[model samples]
Target: MPLEQIRPSHIHQYQNFLEKRELSSTTVRIYLTLIKVICLCINNSSYNLYFSMYSYKR
Candidate 1:
């Protein structure tokens, strides 16, 4: 699924799926944290790229 299409509901559903699979709580939390970090990195990169382009146009 596209990152832009992902929502809080999707994350919650993922957590529920993980729990249903019997994954340990620690493992589920780690997975969620990694997802959040990856999203943050991608968002920051996009912001930086946009800023660079805007600055170049100035």
Candidate 2:
């Protein structure tokens, strides 16, 4: 699924799915944190690229 399309509900669903799979709470939290970090990285990179382009055009 596209990162842009991920929603809070989807994350919640993923947590529930992880629980259903009997994964440890710590593992689930780690997974979620990784996902958040990845999303942040993507968002930051996109913002930086846009800013660079805008600055170049100035």
TM-score of the candidate numbered 1?
0.74
Report the C-alpha lDDT of model 1 over 1-58, residue by residue, as the tens digit.
Answer: 8999999999999999999999999999999998997788688988667666778552
lDDT of 2 by residue, 1-58 (tens): 8987999999999999999999999999999998887787688988667666778552
Q: Considering summed lDDT, which 10 consecutive residues are worst modelled in model 2?
A: 49-58
Candidate 2 similarity to native, TM-score: 0.71
lDDT of each: 0.90, 0.87
Question: TM-score for all predictions?
Answer: 0.74, 0.71
Question: Which prediction has the highest lDDT against the true structure?
Answer: 1
C-alpha root-mean-square deviation, candidate 2: 7.3
List candidate 1 segments past 4 Å from native.
46-58
